[model samples]
Target chain A: MARHLQDTIYKYVTMCLSGVALALIFIIIGVLIDSSYPALVVYGSKFFTSITWNAELTGSICYTSGIAHMCGATFGVLVYLTGTLLSSGIALLIGAPAAVGLAIVLAEIAPRRLASPISFVMELMAGIPSVIYGFWGILVLVPYLKSTLEVGLSHSLSSVPIFSGAVFSAGLLASGLILALMITPIIASISRDAMRQTPEGLKEAGRALGLTDWEITYKVVLPYARTSIIGSIALGLGRALGETMAVALVCGGASNFLPKTFFYPINTMAAFIVFQLDAAFTDPSGMSISVLAEMALLLMAITMIVNVVARLLVRRGFVSRPENLIQV
Target chain B: MEPDREPTNSVQLQDSFSFEGPVRPRNYTRRKALNLFVKGLLIVAAVLVLYPVVDILYLFAYKGLQVISISRLIETTAGAASFNPHAAGGLANAILGTLFIVGLSSMIAVPLGVFGGVYLAEFSNDNRFSSIVRFFADVLAGVPSIILGYVGFLVLVLRFNLGYSALGAAIVLSVLMFPYTVRATELALKRVPNGIKEGALALGSSKTTIINRLSLKFALPGILTGILLSLSISVGETAPLLYTAGFSDYINWTACCHTQIGYLTYVVFTFYTIPTTNAIDLSYLATFLLILIVLVINIVARVGLRRLSRDLESRI
Candidate 1:
């Protein structure tokens, strides 16, 4: 009886302690609301759409910031997002095949000794922080990009809008390339795992049919891992959205009036939040900060939904299917 | 029942890829070229990520090695310059302040984060609390550091009467790290199998004993990994500390409210723009020292984790 009581107490203690995460959320939201109340109540929904943020001209602290001025910031965000998509997409196009090939090389073709180090490198890539990636971008990629883009932009018939300008070192292209390098690990990792989940019997059957090494990778293994590869891309997409320091450092901070040339200066939503929110905190213009919050809320929503879906897909995705491969 | 022994039904995991015929060209040269191109491409990627970390390290060692070696680098503070080559004191105070702030943040955050994760993993079994916690962790992970610092300035530094002490910075960091701790903890805990708990229960051990002695022990290496990752992360964080920690002229010897501790990052940011030659040189040295300190700490912790994991694995 005493043991049972003790057990109940422990469970209660553990369970209650778990509420700490919930408490944190409430606290953060509560504080944001409490601090930003001057703006939230006055503007309400319009606060999100409003753009410009000077407080001196407006009679109230809670001036309705028009979306027109923020167009540059908004455009900055869009350009950065597009940059993210393109780079990440290119990375997938390049990485997925390589990952599938590497999986084949590691699983099907490689000698026993080679697999672990390759696998380790893939994980280590994921572990490298964004700051490190930015450092690399500043040192090597920037100089290379300047020369490379200048040459590409010079010889242009299709250079009408975003592509017309000179390819400066610190614009969308740099951001995209950096983002691509960062997300490659996520895509490669998940895809490699997905391929590994291919049932041994399927590969054996492919070999039995006199399929070459390449044939096994393309025909038998890849199809088996398709759902997982898509799932990995989704996970990588989540990381790309929330990426800070690296993108902020690389993306030119001059908020060009909504993306102009591909090489025009821009900022990501994450970068904008990092760059502006500090000065805004002191005697801050009300609706501007709220709107930033709304953007943050949006970014948070996208990241969470995608990640949860990714987690669900990546973790239990195979379980629903009757025939499974790599149980892990 | 064997773990992977569930009986298969008619449903297949996925469709097999169609290989009706060889539509791909029979050009061996193209295939070889394509493969080589891809290998080079990935190698470039490796270089793209590797070079900057190397550069920052290079700059830190090259320019600052002079100041760092004077042996006074860690001992002095930025007193009014009059000495040869401008001796702007040592990083002793910055080091102490950073340690103090980071330590307090860890002390507050780790227990809360670990418990939240444990609760989600062990108790809830994918209940509402667990789902909410997971979602919050994801969202929190993406919240920008500067915003958190801004938020911290408004809330803790202003409202809480903490007044930008080491405690305030620590609290903000603790909050910043909460999400990672929760995520890492949940992951580590989830990896613990059910059988271990069941066996302990069967042995007449209480649930607390099973949790403390069995489960936590098993989960230690993973928790350590998570904490190490957190520590490494906090080391580079500048913005949150910028707002909450503030600038301490002194070494924060007593960890008091009146004196906010000076951190290496602020000095780097502030000193770089100063008009005086002495201040700029001082800032350069500070940047170098900051990079060195972070690198050393990160590598040492990582090495420690690798050793600990190996030791644990061997014992098991």
Candidate 2:
């Protein structure tokens, strides 16, 4: 009887407390949506699209009842999000093969001595703070790119797209480069593990078929590990999309319009919000723009969607979809 | 991280050779060519990734050592004007402010996160409660420091009347660090032996007692490593600090929050733009210091974790 009581109490305590944590998600959404009801009701979907982020410079004045002002701001986020995608995409391109190759080396070709150091370095890269990367982007990569390739590339691609000018921090190219560097390790790490976990028998079957090394890898190994690669890429997207400090530092703060040219400076929504919103966050009903909060909601929603998708795809379905791994 | 996909190449190479005589030489040449090509690609990629990082670290260390030698690293930035070659004073104030604020935040974050993790891991399993916690922690983890800056401005700055103070910055840092702590603690707790809990319960120990005594003790090393890692990260964060801590000029000796305190990251971020040699030197020193502090703490964390993992293995 006493034991039963203890078990009952344990169950009760566990049930109540465990639910509390998951409940935080609802709470944050509830509070965010609840608190912003005033703005949401006033703006509706206009919050997502309206442009100019005109914050009343002097005190929280109620006179500025213009939602049209934030059109630039809404467009600013889209531009920055695009920049995020481009940079992370480049990283995926560079890192995907390298990561897979490294995994191959470690699992198959490596002499066991080098694997630990390689893994440690990758973790270190991931662990290093974003601010440090920002510092490096400005001080190191910017100068190097300018000195080595900018002049030549500018002359050659003056008429073409994206690479038409000096490699500076204010454009989509540098911002993308920085974001790419940040996520390479992520994709590489995931792809490496997934590929390594391929069943031994799968490879043996390929061997029996007399397939070449390249064919076996392309046909059998990559196919087996495709879902994990997809998951990693998705996760990488989330990181690139939301990265603030590093992107802010490199992305020149211009929320006026999308970069008509890659060389021209542009501002991402996150960068613009960080740079100006704080200094002007106090006014009446739609007076001093609370677009920062609105932006945060959007970023949060994006993260949630990406994370949910990654997790769902990586469920048991990942294991079951061995044949359709690439589709994942 | 290097992906583990190269095994397929080797597997294919060995498999193809076992087939026959005629195709053997052709398969061998193709694979050898592919191997060479892949090796070349790996070399290029590694260099591309490694260069910028190494160059930045090289510049910081080369420049920073001169200043550190002249005035000493942490002891004094006072006689820094005349004694130090060209730089303005030392990083004393920024270092102090960073340590204090991050220290304060870690104190708050580590406990909240650990308890939250324990609640999820032990009581809730990875169920609705755990999943929700995980989601919030994740969203909170990724919810841009800039957004959290808005939270600090809204809640602490105006609503709580804290304004831009060290305490406010610390509060914001704590919030940002919360998700990491919870994630780390949950990971650490997951590494704990289930048998420990079962054994304690068999002896009639209360669930709370077992959680606090047995599981926590087992996971303490990992938890400590998590806390230190989180603290190191907080110390390096500048965005949330930018919004909450504001900025200060003079070295602040007091623990008061009415006035802002100088931090290395803020100095580095802001001063890097100004076209002054002093500003440039100061920025370099700040970046170097920021990197140094994180490196030391991270090394300590890795060492601690290694030792703890060994200890746990021995106990098992």
Fraction of native A-B contacts kept, per candidate: 0.22, 0.26
Model 2 Cα lDDT, one tens digit per residue, A158-249: 88776664555455656767877777666666666677678989888887766565567778887887887777777677777667778777
- Expressed as tens digits, the lDDT of each residue in B1-316 for candidate 2 is 5532455555676988664333343356667788678656665666566555566667788887754544434533343334335645656777888888888888777777777777766777567656766665655665666667666766677667887788899878888777666666666777787887888889888777787778878877777777777777687787788778877765775545578777888877777676655566667788878878777876777765768666885877
What DockQ does model 2 achieve?
Answer: 0.24
- The list of candidate 1 runs beyond 4 A from truth reads A29-136, A155-160, A167-169, A281-291, A316-328, B1-67, B70-72, B75-90, B120-139, B142-147, B158-163, B186-203, B253-260, B264-316
Candidate 1 chain A, which ten residues in sequence have the lowest lDDT sum?
A319-328
- Comparing only chain B with the true structure, the TM-scores of all models are 0.83, 0.84
* Alpha-carbon interface RMSD for all candidates, in angstroms: 6.4, 6.1
- Chain A TM-score values, per prediction: 0.77, 0.81
Across residues B111-175, which tens digit of lDDT does each residue of candidate 1 receive?
98787777777777798767876766655665556557767766777677677778778888888
Fnat of model 1, as a fraction: 0.22
Chain A TM-score, cand. 1: 0.77
